[model samples]
Target: MTWLIVALVLVVAAAGLLRWRRPAWYWLTFGVTLAALRVLVRYGSVMDACGLTVPAPRWRLTLARMTNRPVPGPRAPRILRFRVTRTGLVLRLKLRPGQDAFDVAASCDRLRHSFAMYGVTSRELRSGVVELRMTGYDVLKRVQMPALAETRPMRVPVALREDGAVHYRDYRAVPHGLVIGATESGKSVYQRNLVAALAPQRVALVGIDCKQGVELFPLARRFSALADNPDTAAELLDALVSHMQDVYQLIRAEQRITADVPDAEIAADIWDLPENLRPVPIVVLVDEVAELALFATKDDEKRRDRIITALARLAQLGRAAGIYLEICGQRFGSELGKGITMLRAQLTGRTAHRVNDEASANMAFGDIAPDAVLAAISIPTDTPGVAITGDSAGGWARIRAPHTTLRQAVNVCNRHADLTPDLPALAPFRPALGTLAPVPAPAVESAPAAA
Candidate 1:
């Protein structure tokens, strides 16, 4: 009997340690069963306490009274199905007559606390049914991307969502994106992940890094064009604008708009063009938008206006021409100067990492909920890559990009250098490789050697 007690104590101690250090293992070994039991036993009472219950109907009350039966107090949503996932549980519920998905979503925090879950999110699956996803632990604490699966064209899985789902950077869905974070906020790491993801694909990468070629130049092998200064970036932008016009002209020529032609054959965008004839898509990465916007002299002011205007035009029309913009910065606001807000408006996808102030978060999530801004600013210094991702449509989620070191990203780019596309208009800006020789070793003094 004493041995049995000792074994029980040991098991509990190990579980506690696992829960602290290896949450995923702990969840798989013990947490799942215990969580399931908790939900099954206390669901009804917990729902009632959380006010997620509807009063019994009048007819039911009348029938109970007539039959001399106890009165029904309230009705909680019926659980249609309960599913256990690696990260947490999914509960599909049938809403009570008076209840809707909104109520459940509104009370997610209460539900999360009552169920002892890490996080809870809800979405309506159908008219009367809603799906509640509960996370067993903080998935973002240690980012591990899920197993590879078939992905769609122009989509790259860049991060892990808080709910254990993959967060994809889908260019087709969001043609332009704005990424903002303070220094050492893992903004550069996120960009490296993006570049690595797109390296193997048949696409052209255009980099505008105004930091003296520090950030984006390392992965130059896979980039069709790279500009290390604002002047070159302006020229590159003009070249891209011209390339877009050329693509549009090609699409017009291939429209096949005759009355007898099928509507599907009437090409609109590059995707609709014949595979052999279609030009490769281009992803423009602007390392620091503020660099291009800041100006001191009259010449600098003219240059800044030109650059902003070119960027705005690209954001407005580049989508249909297979050109996408990824604008990254520490802060995106009117302080950068005129036309900044207009460009921000055109970027539908917003991602904010740890920012220095609330105003920076607001600049990133201008069209999203205020809560998103709050979440962005609240990110602690220890967590670097954690960010809030949202879009102009609405809603937001926390995501953390898998860490990709500079060397790893460079290796990836080198591995797929053959996939780099040739864009004639921007060929002048193509990064020159093997142009600089290693610095010669300094010679030792003969007198010092003799001594």
Candidate 2:
């Protein structure tokens, strides 16, 4: 009895050691061996465990009779190879000859669901092939990509998604985007990440900060122009409009609308143009857009109208002209002004962070996806940068931009100052430095000879 106990203890210790040191295959083998031993010890029957009822001698013969014939020589292995990429994991699987890829893909959906619990999934890449991509990993979830993306761009690492894979997207093709969030809801951090990512690229940065440029002024070295007031914002938008017109002219001049050249090849925008002729793209960032819509008097009303009109124009025509808008605000609704809804209509890309008001959440996604509105409103203040992002392609994704410091963004911008472009029209609206002449001190009257 003591020897039996010792033997059982040794078996458990051996199993533990194998489990700790060996790969998954060894653990599976150990489990199968243990199950076999249990069956033998408890039932004293190997045939019963194998689901065999025939006598031992005839059991092998019966199994052979039930099995089908083998295939031709050099049978291929059924396995797929994959690697985790920045956007997602990439799987490469070769299909068996005469096998349907679609059937395999449909079958993989169940596998994808099973893997989703661990942040992994399978997606069909092409016929006769597939990729095991990460659906939502947790580690790289909060990084923000640049607006003007490049082919095979270097990925900026952050935390992984819930699935344990990198998280990223190409924003250049996404064009314009709206970021709506309540105050202190981490929207600014996301913006900082976005700016830092784009600073190294050869692109124009424009900022409209109605909060006395509090949010964007620190990064002025990277911005071609920064507007602090509504009037200044108007001037900046006008200048951008002029720049858009120039870019449009350039595209038209280089337009290659021909039967031989496909629409994809036509030089319609900066991206579509030939590399040598393509000019850098421009990204316009607007902070607290509500200020541009607010008015206290009749004069303010007229100014708001012009400002909204210019924004609407930019939203309408600037996309194809290589100018994109990243408009952020606490609230953006049709009730804000006459052209507010009109402008919203043109902003195909939408992102809503945690918002204080349901109206703001509604403005961000109500027109497009009603479900997204619910998601936006449900976001808690504690998770600031978490947002629902919808693109023009009708696909929506939940993303959390990384927490980027204002000082880090400013430093990045300053380091990349040489790339900043000169926008002649916007130059006048730039914040004046202290070098400007000081106002004359008001003359103080004597105390009327001590009364």
Top candidate (TM-score): 1
TM-score (all chains, Cα) for each model: 0.93, 0.67
lDDT, residue 164, candidate 2: 33
lDDT of 2 by residue, 120-239 (tens): 344456766755454322433334343344333212332123333334434455567788888787788878877887788777788999999899988888888888999878877888
Clashes of 1: 0
Candidate 1 per-residue lDDT, tens place, 90-150, comes to 8999998988788899999998888899999998999999999889999999988878844
Cα lDDT, all candidates: 0.92, 0.68
Best by lDDT: 1
- Whole-model lDDT for model 1 versus the true structure? 0.92
Give the deviation of candidate 2 from the true structure as CA RMSD. 11.5
Clashes of each: 0, 16
The regions of model 2 sitting more than 4 angstroms off are: 1-137, 140-171, 256-266, 272-277, 357-359, 431-451
For model 1, what is the alpha-carbon lDDT of residue 280? 90
